[model samples]
Target chain A: METKMVISNLLHRPTRTIISILAVAIEVGLVMLTVGMTTGMLSETARRVEGIGADIIVQPPGASFLMGFTPAPMPIKIGDLLEEKVEHVAHVLPVLILMNVGVGVNIVFGINREQFDAVTGGFVFHSGGWFTGPDDIIVDDLYAKAGHLKVGQKLTLFSHSFRITGIVEHGKGARLFIPLQTDEELNQTQDKASIFFVKCTDPGYTDDAISGIRQFLPTYPVRSMAEYTSLYSSNNLPALNTFIEALICIALTIGFLVIFLSMYTTITERTREIGILKSLGASKSYIMSLILREAATICVLGIAAGEVGTLGARRVLQSSFPTLAVRLTPHWMVYAAVLAMGGTVLGAVYPALRAASLDPVDALAYE
Target chain B: MEPIILTSDLKKIYRIGKVEVPALRGVDLVVPEGEFVAVAGPSGCGKSTLLHVLGGLTAPTSGKVLVDGNDFSAMNDADRTRFRRHKIGFVFQRFNLLPTLTARNNIAIAQHIQGNGFNPHRFQAIVEMLGIQGKLNHRPYALSGGEQQRVAIARAVICEPKILLADEPTGNLDSENSQIVLNMLRGLNRSFRQTILMITHNPDAAALADRVLRMRDGRMLLD
Candidate 1:
């Protein structure tokens, strides 16, 4: 009976089609925003863990200073500071990675792996083996993504000219590593070690090691792997999360209300008819199911619309944030869709029950 | 044959704030299978009330209503509705065709609601027989008063219910359309052996029935 009425009503009025579309679109947009932000955070986190050049980052005092490009270059002497003072700081490989990147002064890190692994087991040279010799600079893929460099592309910085040998991606922050000898020669800092990475007997020693290093080097800073990643993430995001969350909440609230009211009015309009149906032998469940059938129809349409709206919204919003660390993964898409559909069902509960529980006698006589 | 419909000492009293207006008072009735019986009375009589009680659309305060030998009072509301769906048809004063549906679909839904599959040939025949061949696809709002009445009749008769209760079926129609609707009803009564219980104020419309039931003050004065 409900099936017949649902199909009949859909075909008859069909204006409800427009309403369903609009409702679903709003719902989907909300979900997309939520899942999109969630996804962005997840992707950025993954990227941060997937460090770029140095398998391990060596910085002064804190991760922020390393990520910040404002470093207090280590004192006394570059090689002597680590070689003479610290224990378990076995190999003191000195390399200059932090500097102003392009003509616009973007932060950058250049590595020299032969000198790098002499102290810490950090980054692996993925494609072209570690900067085995001088002038071999493996630039981070951001330069390519930023349309700054390609293979064989020459980047002339403050003191050195580099021919990009390979493009590399870092799991952690946005820094590049070249050969240490070349970096040191360019910076002309024979007496300076901006920072040093030390290999300990255990990964658990990381906290103690950082604390221990900070004690002797009072003015400097130190941080662990996770902390380092979080610093980059917090620095890059904050606003994206806050904006999307607010927009999604508002859209969902307004959309659900619209759908709820639309359904309510439909029930109100058909109150008398429902009574007639009840009189015609429809059970409470049967009547309820009949009305809920409309809700179901609306949900199906709404979910589809919301998904499309989300996609459209994502595309439109992408241009506003250039370094949007989120990847639009399919898993995130499915999650958003489920949210859109589930929200519609949740929103439909009150109206469906209200229409269902109506007394057939009263309903029939209702004007 | 046992009476298909039997009501024993049925009563309906509507309470308005403090006063109780008795609509039906211990009314006993028996309508046999395929019998054409007219219940006649002036306005306010219990003819309409009687029809509603017999059809199980309204429950009497006391007594028994049996349709096809089953006790209506004994069954629950759901069971009573099931009985109404399978055994009865109604044609209202306003010719209550659902305004949204086409004439054909309106008739078709009654059958579908009763779980009967569509038989186009039977539908086509019924529409043609009712002289609504040209207006099958027209909605109630699009059709004239007369045409809408015929469509209502078409819906009622198409289900081929055992008893058809028509409450002033031609009250809203003109004389010409009245004749058309009445003739179509009478044709259904004779050809299909339908048992019709129709109430009307129009003498001309009532005159067409095998029996005319006039109602007044919620009770029938004559039969």
Candidate 2:
């Protein structure tokens, strides 16, 4: 019965209820969307790193683990240096990283043709064959589907049109691939590659190989494939924790202010009603409970709307940016809901206190 | 029988920007159990203040108000509030029914606040006495002025408190509706032997009570 009163009171003013609910929903949806995008990118980067079939990765020191496209180049001679200096070295492949400006935020991996094929397990090509020329590029199925490109179609990057020589399955490598020399010539970087991929002759000795390479190039960062993938998971994404903390603050503030203003004005409008309740033998605690219950009911309904809104938003984003993965896990939704509800309850405290403290005589006399 | 409510030297002062305005000035009063008493006065004679203090909605500046021989003046805010919920009920001039609630729930809430859930038998009796049984589901806006007042009276008596404090119960009613509402109150008082303290400016309204007291300028006048 008390719940019924709360619901009736909130529904009494449709416009006010809608505005407050929308405020909460929008804040929660934004938190979910932004956080989902960040985690999704982190997961995608980790997956791509593991797909290259390399046992170890050697990059410049201090390179961001999740920043797959960062131009942190090292000498291409590091490939040979590893093969000569490390005992377990089987093959070392150098990869140049280039940014694809024409087609969204994508990384282009430039590799030596022979070493790339040998180390990449040779692509399970869906159409066409390997890139036979310097100006040719190969794409995976995901990129082809996202960009509506196929074999024999030309893709324009850096104002240069290159024919798509092949389309392979995704999870094999980065979406776009080019010749190492072609990338170096186009980007004005001669004899430089972003990082080196090292394979050990004995699979069981990869850990030792990584340690040996680290010693040979102490200034460079070296990690086994498993370690590298784990490094790029959501927990290790640089600045991701800080970004979520800032978002939580923003979401909580929005929830608090909207609910506070709503409940404050609502209590003010119902001052006479509160007076009547008091005169009808209502205790101060009774009045407080009434106000708090109403506020909590609003919060619950708002959170429900926010949860549904987030699901709808995820679908729309996936359709709009097919290549952009959005990880809207159940855990994230629950966290957002709890945070929103907590903020709303806190917001209602002052208004509930004010209502409970009203002087019955003065409030009853209010016009 | 002992007086169910007693007040001696009851005074309430209002502060208006450093000015002390006395709303109740050393008023002494007594009402025995089962008595229906009316306090008649002009506006600003502090009748409402006296009613508020008697109901424990407001505290007196000095002296004592004992309801059921328990000192209300000595009780703290929380205790006074609890006392009011269990021991007193109120009806106002404006018929202060919650507009958002149905007439039935309005009455039921009185019992709900008394820390007891609704009693179906008691609720039915009050609604029948007030002739508001069929109108229980209607909101306040849908009820007539007389119906609204009767619902208010029913709400006040639903908890069966020791005293019912009414401030101008029929002030917002037409002459016909006023008589009907007064009749309901008289019927309830006679049937249940309920104690009532009513504040009113109408002579006819006062005439319905078992005893009448008149006040002017915050002091009881000889009637």
Candidate 3:
């Protein structure tokens, strides 16, 4: 009977109920989508970096694990030193990475074709061969498809134009690649490399190569490729975690305020009905439970709607921006639902208490 | 029979800002078990206030009220509410059925609040007696004034409370509906020996009771 009353109350005012549900849905969607996009992009980028086939990476001291943020401060001779001096090092590639914010934020890697091919197994080119000229650029299939690019198309980066010489399969170090010498000259940092990619003679020799690199460049950041993906988590970026937390707080506030106002209005409108219940020998807890139950029902419905809405949003986002990855992990979905439920329940407590404490005589006399 | 309802110098004062307005002025009353008693007065003569006090809806200012051998004045808010849940039922003039619920649910809610599981037999008997069996599926808005009143009575008595406190149960009904509701109350009183205390200004309504008590200006007049 109590459940029936709650459902009837919600159905009695369709517009208010719908608006409340939408508010909660929006809150859940906001939290899920924002967190999903961040985690998805991080893992996607990490996977691509791992696909470069480097057994170990050596960056300049104080350099971030995100290669895009690292400057070309390390001398290019580090690659030759690791190759000649370090044991178990089969190949070493000196790469200069620059962050490009043209249509979107991306990293462009500069590589010597022969050394890059040796270190990274080799690029599986879908079309065109290798960089034909110093101004030629090799793009991955994803980047080419996103920009509607074909071989021989002219692309501009860092205010310099380059012809597309090849479209390779994705999952290399970066989406765009250029000649190492040209990148060094263009950036006016000749003989300097942002990082060194070391390929060990055997996959099991990764830890040995990392130790060898650490002996030579003790202050430099040498990370084994096996653990590279784990380093791309949100915990590695405090700023990103803070950003997600702030967004979640905003979503919680939205859910809280909407539920509060909705329940407050409902209590006011149903003052007489509350009195009627009291007259029928309802206890304070009974009245409180009724109000809270109504709010919970709305929240449960809103959560279901939000889950569906977020999935639809993910599909739309991925379709619109194929390069964009949105991962809706089961744990994050559960977390978001719990957060929304907690906020909405907290929002309803005040109104429920107010309803419960109402004087039966005054409530009955309330016009 | 010993008095099922008893009041000793019952007094209730309404505090409005700095002014203390007395609604019940030290009036003593008693009604024995299974009696149909009527409290009649003009508007604002403390009839509803007296009923509210008797029903444990409000506390008396400075007096003793014992209903069904429970001291209402001494009980705290929660205790009073519990006592009301187990021992008292109420019907108001407005036919205060929850607009959102069906007639059936409105009646069932009382049983739910009484903390007892539904008794289908009692429910059937109550609905049949009130002639609301066919109208149970309808919401309050779909029912006539008389039908809504009947539903309200069924909701009040579904738990078989020791006392039924009615405040102008037929005030919103026409003469035909009022007569029907009054006759139902009389039938309930005679058939089940239900103790009823009704408040009204209608002489005809008062005449249906076994005894009529009049009040003026918060003080009960001679019977």
Writing each residue's lDDT as its tens digit, candidate 1 over A129-206 gives 455457666755544455556777676666567766766654424345666556557766554456554544455666
Looking at candidate 2 chain A, the ten consecutive residues that score lowest on lDDT are A63-72
Chain A vs native chain A, TM-score per candidate? 0.60, 0.91, 0.97
DockQ for candidate 2, C-alpha atoms: 0.81
Indicate whether candidate 2 or candidate 3 has the larger TM-score.
3
Docking class of 3: high
Give the winner by lDDT. Answer: 3
Model 1 score (lDDT): 0.65
Select the stronger candidate by lDDT from 2 and 3: 3
Total clashes, candidate 1? 50
For each candidate, report its DockQ versus the true two-chain complex.
0.28, 0.81, 0.90
TM-score: model 3 vs. ground truth: 0.98
**Cα error, candidate 2, residue B65 (Å):** 1.2
Q: Evaluated on chain B only, what is the TM-score of candidate 1?
A: 0.92
Q: Which stretches of candidate 2 lie over 4 Å from their true place?
A: A66-72, A80-88, A233-240
Ranking by lDDT: 3, 2, 1
The better candidate by TM-score, 1 or 2, is 2
Q: Which 10 successive residues of model 3 chain A have the least lDDT summed?
A: A64-73
Q: Can you give the lDDT of residue B72 in candidate 3?
A: 87
lDDT per residue for candidate 1 within B1-223, as digits (tens), equals 8988787777788778999989898777777777666566676777777877777776777787788887987877667778887888877776666666788877887777666677788788789898899898888889999988888777776767889888778888888888888888888888888888877777777777766544566644454
lDDT of 3 by residue, A1-367 (tens): 8888898899999999999999999999999999999999998998998999988888898888887788547989889999999999999999998888988798889999899989988999999979878999999988888889999999999889999999999999899999988888877888889988889999898888888889999998898886766899999999999999999999999999999999999999998889988887888989999999999988989998999999999998877776788989999999999999999899999999999999999999889
Best by DockQ: 3
